[model samples]
Target: MLPKSYFDIFLVILLVPILNLFVYLHNSFSTSLSYLGLPYFIEPDITVDADHVSSSSSPATRRCNIPLSALLLRELLPVVKFSNLVDPPNSCSVCFKDFETEDEIWRLTNCRHIFHRSCLNCWMGYDQKTCPLCRLSLVPHDKEEMYNERLWRLCNNCQL
Candidate 1:
C-alpha cells in the first residue's frame, strides 16, 4: 500500500485542479453577473401573504358597488365647457401631440382639460388629482355630483 505521505500528496494533487477550476469559474461568472442589475448572488420569487388579496383577483360578486368616488372630475360632469384652443386641435398636452392627424382629437375628461389617455394615464399613475388644464380638484367629496363643481371652484381659486 502507498505511504500516508503519498496519499496526502495524491489528495492535494487531485484537489488542486478542481480548486483552481472553481476559482476560475467563479471569477468568470462573477464578472458576467455584475453586468446584470442584481443586488445579490441569488434572488427568489416574490410572494404575498394570504391576508393580502390582489386587487385584480377580487371577485366581481363580492364587490357589489363601483367606487363612484374614484371617478375623476371629468367623468363627474359632462356638461362643462372646455377649450381645445389651449393646446391645439391635434396638439394634445398629455402626449405632446404634434398635430399629426385630424382624427387625433384629445378628449378632456369631465375636468374641462385635455390630454391623451396615454399621457393622462401616465400622469394619473403618479396620483395627481387635478385636471392638467383647468386645475380642477378631482377628489370625491361625497356620492353627490358637487364633486365636479367643487373641483371647478378649486380650479377657479387656483387661477386667482
Candidate 2:
C-alpha cells in the first residue's frame, strides 16, 4: 500500500476539484430556484362576442387622459421668491435649473414638490401621469372617476 502521507495527498488532490464543482452547482441551482419563486404579473384574458363581429379583436379598456385645467395651470401654481422655498431651495426638481423670478413655478398637489411649469407640463404630457419626485398618480383613481372629475372641473370653470 502507499504511504499514509501519499494517500492523504492523493485524496486531497482528487476531492478539492470535486467539492468545488459540487458547491458551484448547488449555488447555481439555488439562484435559479430563487428566480423561479418570484411573482410575475399576468395580463387579463380577452374575449370576443360571436354576434357582433368586429374587424379588430382586441380588449377594450378605457384610456385615461391628462386633465389640464386653467385653474391648475394658472391659480394653483403660484410663483414664489427662490429664497423663500422650504426644501430643495432655489431650483426646479424636474429641470434641475435655478429658479429665477421670471420662471413659472408649479408645485405638485400630492408630494408638494416644486418644478418649472413648462418642464412639468412637458413631463405630464409625454413621459408619465405620475409625479416625477414621488411617483403619485396625478389623475384620479379610475378612468370613470377621472372622466367625471374632468367634466365637473370643466362645467364649474365654465359656470355652466
Candidate 3:
C-alpha cells in the first residue's frame, strides 16, 4: 500500500479546490442576497416542543404584492434632439433592436441612458430595476421627473 503521507497529500490536493468552490458560492449567494435587500440572518419565531409546536405570524409569511402602477412611474418619451447631443443613439441597449423614428423610448432620469419603451418596461417589471448599462438605480428619488442633461453633454464631449 502507498504511504500514509502520500494519501494525505492526495486528499489535500483534491479537497482544496472543493473548499474554494464552496467559499466562492457562499460569497456570491451573500452578494446576491444583499443586492435583493434581504437580511442576511432571519430569526424564526416558531418553536417545536415534545408534544406540540407553536408558531407566530411574521412579515416573512406575507406575500409581496407590488403593483404595476409603481413600475409605470418612469418616464417614456420619443427620442429628441438636445443641444448637448451631437448624435442620438439609434438602438435599444437591452434588446439590441434598432429604434425607428417614431419609436417610443424610456430615458432613465438619473444615468440618462435610453432604451426602447417596451424593453425598459419589461426589464424593470421583472428582471432588474436598475440601468442595464451603468447599473444605476432606476427609481427616482422624488416625485418630480428631472432629467440630467449634463450626462448627455458629457457623452457628447467624450464622443461615446
Please state the error at residue 67 of candidate 1 in Å. 14
What's the true lDDT of residue 38 in model 1?
A: 36
> Which lDDT tens digits does candidate 3 get at residues 1-80?
88999999999999999999998988887788768865343323322121211122212332232222222334323334
For each candidate in the order shown, give its overall lDDT on alpha carbons. 0.47, 0.55, 0.54
Rank all candidate structures by their lDDT, best first, as comma-separated numbers. Answer: 2, 3, 1
TM-score of each: 0.32, 0.38, 0.39
lDDT of 1: 0.47
Count clashing pairs, candidate 2: 0
Against the true structure, candidate 3 has what lDDT?
Answer: 0.54
Question: Compared to the true structure, candidate 2 yields what TM-score?
Answer: 0.38
Model 1 lDDT per residue over 35-68, tens place: 8843234332222112222223322222212222
Backbone clashes in model 3, listed as residue pairs: none
Lowest summed lDDT over 10 consecutive residues: which window, candidate 1? 59-68
The residue ranges of model 2 lying beyond 4 angstroms of the native Cα positions read 1-88, 139-148, 151-160
lDDT tens digits, residue span 1-160, model 2? 9999999999999999999999898777767755885211122222222222222323223212333332233333355544555664567777788888666566655567778777777775563667788898554343436444654644444331
- RMSD in order of candidates: 14.9, 16.1, 16.1
